[model samples]
Target: MLAESPPETEQSAPPPVARPRHAARAAGLLIALAVLALVAVASIAVGAKPMSLDEVWHGLFHYSGTVNDVVVRDLRVPRTVLGVLVGLGLGLSGAVMQALTRNPLAEPGILGVNAGAAAAVVSAISFFGAATLDEFIWWAFLGAAVVSAAVYALGGSRSATPVRLALAGTAATAALVGYINAVQLMDTKALDKLRFWTVGSLASATMDTVEQVAPFLLLGVVLALTLGRPLNAMAMGDDTARALGAHLTRTRILSMTAITLLCGAATAACGPIAFVGLMVPHLARLVTGPDMRWVLAYSAVLSPVLLLGADVIGRVVTRPSELQVGIVTALIGGPVFIYLVRRKRMAQL
Candidate 1:
């Protein structure tokens, strides 16, 4: 017994648990940036008219008074810039909406925000004769805010579930769409003006328009990025989020404000471009995991890449008569949406 007691063995420590690798995420971010740069250059160079890469470089860095330079500087440049800004806004807004509603399908286009803005702008055009985007910007902002508030109210208070939110969004969007069609039917002049706005194009992009919406876009982006932590908390269930000391009311209000600013400004600039919000967030999440901060970052970068790339494709595909970016995005997004649905990821919301 004394000999057996002398043979006690020692225990070893457990192996360290492995954390998720971030190098891949960083690489993905870099890849997105590279693609965005390439797409921006392609957007400038590969328009309906032929232009050399040298010309594009000169137009960007060293400008001379030439027709090619003018086209690059005046037309494509503004359009490309607007595309980037709008894409960023829409992409971030979509991620925010999904996080807020805890529904993957939630987006500005789906939630009646764009429809409300469209309705308001048409109302302003037909009734007030607001001919300029500058005049109608306020109308768009007001409409977006009102509709968002209405959706939240109908959806539920602080503890609204995703199903109720989605249902409320669908109902509001349908009602607004019907009203928009009625208004357009009544006023042919308004219809003519609304055609381009409703279709969504960067063709009419001007520096003035860029300047007008820049402030809103910048503010929205900053606010959205700041909300990453709160959003992450929210993704874990409302009770858990509250336990983590996340302010639900404040988060909701700020998130709604950010969405309004982003979507209203974007819809005003380039009609209601659908699917960017829906598609971009999904792609971003695939790269960034379930972390809202990384998801938002990836969405902001990749969205512009998709948007500008689509615009370039639209420009090159038709040759003489170019397709609008909205149409192009729809064509691309429809298949992607179908694929996602088939994958059964939609139910994961």
Candidate 2:
């Protein structure tokens, strides 16, 4: 006791481990936000028609209907805005989907959302002769909603086991893709039109398109952010999540609702862009670790960075002929996906 008393000098406690992680997450989120801003500006400034930073600023703020002003105001602004919205939707959907399925590889398409939307749009083009994107948008949304609901109903009928959900989605996606292909093959006009639509790009983005999808996206995002704690618990496993007082059925329904809204709106607006959802969330997880809240937050910002940056690159690399955002994303995502597979970290989640 005396020896212990002699050695009882005060020692400072070390900082909590979580503090550094939280700090790093905050710093990463800020960097992602900054990159998103930079990429968005680049999206506006470095399109098929170039514009200086000053011209972009003037066009955005003070426009008197000059050519540059028209380009910036009418074209790039909507396109850029749509990119941000679509990216956010896809990114959030992917993160939610992965947690819901307990599969790291899950994306928006895993639920047949994109395939269902594409099939409906293709049918409209072929049989219904819907000429414009605006005309077919309702069909796309309906298809996505129906397919997603069906997936959940089938998967959760007995129990919302991950295997059942994934299998249902895969089967539905295969069927939808088959229908889309059959329609496109039978109608040349549909093929010509659907070709552009299927590849997915912001080339046709307009203020009307942005406005139409904005409300759904906003609602979905608000709802999605609220599910972070539930998702984090779910990531540990259903039993653990339930033991932690999370309502499994309620969480599943809410997650599906959020995914349906976000994916439906995104596919409707931008015509089924791929891989942004698959890749962005994984990248987010790499930075933010297993905390679903941080993963979602990081995804929401960095997804736009990837999308806008890819779009900008597509614009510049092709000069007069730009690649679609979907194509570019696939090109980028394939390698990233492969790397993730090789690393085996994705196997854990």
Best by TM-score: 1
lDDT score for residue 62 of model 1: 84
Q: Show the colliding residue pairs in model 1.
A: none
Q: Write the per-residue lDDT of candidate 2 for residues 1-349, one digit (tens) a residue.
A: 4545333344444467968989989998998898899888788888888778899889989998999999999999999999999899989998888887776767777667787877887877788778875667678778877887788688784356655766788899888878887878888766877777787888889999899889988888988989999988987877898999999889988998888888878887878877788888888877888888999898899888888888888888988888888889988887875675567344646
Q: Model 2 segments beyond 4 Å from truth?
A: 1-15, 129-137, 149-175, 189-192, 342-345
Instruction: Report clashes for each candidate as comma-separated counts.
Output: 0, 0
- Candidate 1: 10-residue stretch with minimal lDDT: 10-19
lDDT of 1 by residue, 208-287 (tens): 89999989998999999899999999888879999999999899889999999998899888887878888999888877
| TM-scores for every candidate against the unseen true structure | 0.89, 0.86
